[model samples]
Target: MRPLPGLAAASVLLWGCGPAAPRMAATPVPEASATAGVSSALRPTAGASAEPEPIPAGRASPPERYDDGVDVLHYDIELALPRGSGWMQGHAALDLRLDRAVTAVDLDFSGLHIDEVTVDSGPVEWHHEDGLLSIPLGSPAEAGARHRIAVAYRGVPDDGLILGETVHGDPSAFVDNWPNRTRFWLPSVDHPSDKATARFTVHAPAEWDVIANGRAAGPPVPTPPEVPGPSVGERRTWIYETAVDHPTYTLVVGGADMVIDTVGLAACGEAPVSPRADGCVAVTTWLFPDSRAEGASSFRRAADMVDVFTDMIGPFPYEKLANVQSATRFGGMENSSAIFYSQQAIAAGRDIESTVSHEIAHQWFGDSVTEADWSELWLSEGFATYFGAVYFERVDGMESFRERLAGAARAYLTSADTLRPVIDRRGDLFDMLNRNSYQKGGWVLHMLRREVGDDAFFAAIRAYYARYRDATATTDDLRAVFEEVADRDLARFFGQWLRAPGYPVLSVSTRDLRTGLRVEIEQVQGDYAPRFHIPVDVEVTWDGRSVRATVPLEGAGGVWIVPGAPADARVTLDPDGWLLHRLHGSPPSP
Candidate 1:
């Protein structure tokens, strides 16, 4: 999720509803209500005209646990998109295994009206209310038991699936299910923990071209006339399926009359054995026909980014990659195999390389190696943010990387979320998208890289990705991998950066001594800030020559003596931008 610049401050107000309340059982849908247009629960009730109060900041909370009794293995979804109306027909088949013996199964679903539900081709008693669909099993099923459940429904979605016109005023439909909004259109366990393979069969207007997750099963086929739906000229059916499982947030489908250009096959740092080689992934760009030139220019390096990250991390986790210009709410959405960028940005011809790299990096961290809990989102957003800078370092040089880190430090210092810890357990999940999770999170990784040598750092990164690929992880999971590779206790290092609310604020002064120049450092960030154990790099300059030394500053403060230094020596702190701290009084001398 690449938030548009300056959009974080407004996100809470825009998406004030936050994650939906926990699901609860409701009365069964009466047979007469099967044909209802939309669930009454979704519509605004009486006295709803008043303007709602703003959602307080730092008020969102994540679920206590992730598991929801059933583990979904696959979702076979078929949706018939209407040509003019907002309502659409949907049929979903879920193949799942029970984690524990249960008398009923609950699925996260809302807005849509259910026509029927069946378990193993038999109709079962079910209830739908408060965004949850509960199906009674009639008997307790033992753990490990597998079943295929099917749901038939239809309605106008309230969110997740955005049905509207594109920037070019052409009809378009795109799925934008970040956080936990998938329940608005699709019925399943809408949590990141229960990742599952998916097959999307979409029926849309014949003129539109559809793109979805994974490789297309085949070319577009004409919708049969016998199929039941509103008559809207010729309709085409698009089928796509993912061989690998991923979180629900990343699953998406986009449809529009657009131009798609194939950049080339991106190989994993080597020439492919053949055109269809296993080591290579095809890279393409989808854009509105009017902005073809701008889109092509912006996404010209799509394949190169794939190659760089593949070599740096492990392998590309998906079959192919598509950078699409769509009507996404975010500036850039890292949707598994297909990434969606803000249509406005591309139409205006802005240089979106940084945003593109950020989203592409998420294909590895946020998409493949997901964070199990929202509180540990730094494992996803932070990794992507830092690795985006690393991409520049590999191509542009170390100086460019240092500049990027300095910019991140500035952003963190200026952000309103400066007083919050990166792993904030409280607050609206949207608030987690602040500097604490992104800029500071990247700083944490940068500081860790400095602590551990480049060799061990990159080695641990590869190991962690290989271990958690196609799965979920937490900050501790990452710490374990780094500790194993570096062979050191990193508890203090991670705690101070991730758990602590604020960074080290230091006041430094230098004086002349008979033995050498004396440098005194004091931590004055108040009581809330942790007493950081920092390795400070001090450079003392005099008479055309300079001496550099690493001084270990712990607890409140420390004193380091530079022997044989002149009385009028000039001092500079963190000359290479290696630490995240603020200095009081005068700035470091140039």
Candidate 2:
């Protein structure tokens, strides 16, 4: 997800370049018994049954920190949306496997009226309050047992589902379910750790077009009278489904009168599975009619972006990709296969390619390989931020990539959030959207790439994605993969950059000696900051001659003496822009 415009403007000002792109509670369940057939990865962790520690007075705990004892496998949702009406009718059927034997199940849902609920097609008693829907199963279901539960609900949503007008004043409805907002309308596990394939059958006025996750089963079919719902005249049902498993936040539905265009196909290059047999994924754009020309032009390279990521990372994770211009609160929301961009940004013809690429990168990182815990959001946002710059590096050039990273570094250094670590533990889930998670997190990846050579770095990336493609991962999970591929332990590297706050602050001075040029470097970021291990690159130039040296600085300071050079030499630190650091004083001219 891209940051909002206000934050983007601040980023652009700091980088001195283009614009920047951009919860619920649950019930407790008994611990699961041992099962011989279940994969260990799918089973609840050892600490799953422990009660969460109470949050101190004002601090907000991470939203994804709860367990509900069930692993949802699939969701079949049917929604009834009427033109110009706030109320929506929905029927959601969830197929989930029990991790423990329990007589009751709890799901995250709120602000909607529950018409009915059935466990395996039989009526069940339920209770709803404080954002949870509790259902009594009448009998305990053993571990590994699978059950189908259906819920019929209706009401005007307070959030998650945005029912509003587009920039051009066209009536539209879009789902903004990032974090844990999916429960406002659709009920399920609603956590990133529990992923499930989904099928959406949406009923709307015939004039409206609907776009959702996965591929469309077929063209819109007239709504049959047998489908129970409020009388919305002349309605059609649009059905879409995805075989690939994804988290609830990425599941979405958008309905509006819009213009749709096909932007060619992206070659998947012998991927195990492709939308078509030819190994290609279809790329398209959906925009409000008034802004179709500009919006389509903005995403003209949508297909190319997919191809670039598919080549860099493993395969494209979804069947098809749709970039939609909608009424999303963020600058752009990476909603699995269907991405939603800010309607105003497209309508105003802003240069949003950076935002575009950022969201697209999330499909591979944030959407497919999700972060198990919200505290590990850098795994999502940081990957997208850096990979977005990498896209430009491939298509544009190295300079463009450097400039973007430089801008990001500047943004991080100047922001107040720099005081926090990338994997921050405190504050509201939304508060995690700081420079620490986005900019500094990207810098961490950048520096990691520099620490490990390109060969080892890219190899680790591919291996990590393949291992966690349809699952959750933490910073440690990533480190283990890199360690396995690079053949080295990167504990210090990740610790100083991610676990600790602030970057290396240095004060350097140079003086000419009879033997050569003398360079002194000192770490001056105060005692609170960790002493970083940095491989500093210093370049010296004099009389049309230039030489470079790498200085391994550890602890508080280090000195490097150049064996050759003149007294009148100019010095440059980190000339290649590999380090995220700050210079306290001017370097002395020899």
Candidate 3:
């Protein structure tokens, strides 16, 4: 992945590197009522009344989308990796269509040493500088034209692809490109906004197995290339093809002593037969040979996860699924058909099942229909995190799911003071991978599902996936889909949660009056501009009877008449986890 120009390139520190804590952070059950959407209403704290200024255009620029005059059709990349040198030579053939007349084509490329460049099988004037490769077309290419730029280059990518060594001196490597790290390795329009179908022909030493983004098109064919002197070792070339259109970030290459195997799709659960799709979807695993047994055991129910998500959305969108235990910086990266997991987390076997589920969820959200820009990354990361919980509930019980949601809420709330909105674009690209994107993003989805009924929510998800499969989308795109399915205007609902900073902190007060229980809800968030227009539920309990009712709580504050309750009743705000916030009660305010 390519970091924005001048921005430092850094990978997410793995759980292994961070403080030793539970992979999923969830504190013990705290004060229950106060934890859910209620906080200190009158606490002395500074508040900003003005709306957070919309992210400035040049503050955090979205990645370049140069699809105006030319658009990439497909990429056939032939990569040759010589063992031990950490260097790779590549020959890339980029098929493109000219949408309009173009005198030049700009491609994102960095680090690689270019040997030769051609346009439509002929020599072309080319310039490579500061990560952008500019190729002049001699004269303006006609509109609706077709051309292919073939490039021969070689270099060692320091960032996107890393050669990591295990404690036992086993040479291992993985590609860890999130946000915009693809340009540090492969060349093309590296932004998620410009995606293309890809084919990979990879060469690695015979001892190390090669893994790419897609399923293997055929068996590994040996290619004994002529070297200048004595060759280092026996090398082989593997062919893989992914017809699915995905962002460059999903393209990956890893070589390790990993054992690959297949498990039945029925293992995930009852596999749903896609009407237009044929064949039983196969679940595959790539793990280090030493830990093959435990790694395979850890990923046992991956097939079930596939079925669970497919049943929830639509059919499995990719060719097949491969869970690779790699040396990736992230705990797990959902790279199209091939998902890479950190070896450290895999060895521990903690949260392995849920991690696998998370990556598989991305096959639909992140890989098939990608986020149009980094600002909308929650559409990918958050969806994966939420669906992982869904799978957790399916495999475990409701308690586990509740625990997961509670964990996410806790993580988000703890970071609330320093939190940015889900659709933030003002900071570095890496900032998009924060608690907001993973946990809070999931909470937003959970709340949306609660806002619309389960039927409508699922329908919206299926429709969204069906409409955008093999394409790219944005936060507005998803909001529109949800509104269309639910048939309700959800602009405020999305805006307050997605664009607003911090979260709703409600101060609750209830009186058991004769005319039902009088309940008051107030929004006391750190920011005053966002008065969350959300559905609130007031739960009342007295004399072994409990009742829950929806009350109007759309902004600063609102008084509600809770029916079917005695005057003297204990009221709990949002008893069923519909709203994500901290709740606190006031002592009648003097």
lDDT of 2 by residue, 289-364 (tens): 6676556567878888988988888888988898998878889999998999988777766779899899999999
TM-scores for all predictions: 0.88, 0.89, 0.84
Error of 3 at 235 (Å): 1.1
Which portions of model 2 show Cα errors greater than 4 Å? 7-65, 269-273, 586-590
Local accuracy by lDDT, each model: 0.79, 0.80, 0.72
* Per-residue lDDT over 253-297 for candidate 3, one digit per residue giving the tens place of the 0 to 100 score: 888776677755532322232211445566778766555544666
What is the number of residue pairs that collide in model 3?
Answer: 17
lDDT of model number 2: 0.80
What clash pairs does model 1 have?
A: 60-427, 60-428
Sequence-dependent TM-score of model 1:
0.88
Between candidates 1 and 3, the one scoring higher on lDDT is: 1
Q: Could you give candidate 1's per-residue lDDT for residues 321-440 as a string of tens digits?
A: 889988888889999989999987776666788888889899999899999887888988998899988999999899988888888888888666768789987556677788898989
Which ten residues in a row are the worst by lDDT in model 2? 39-48
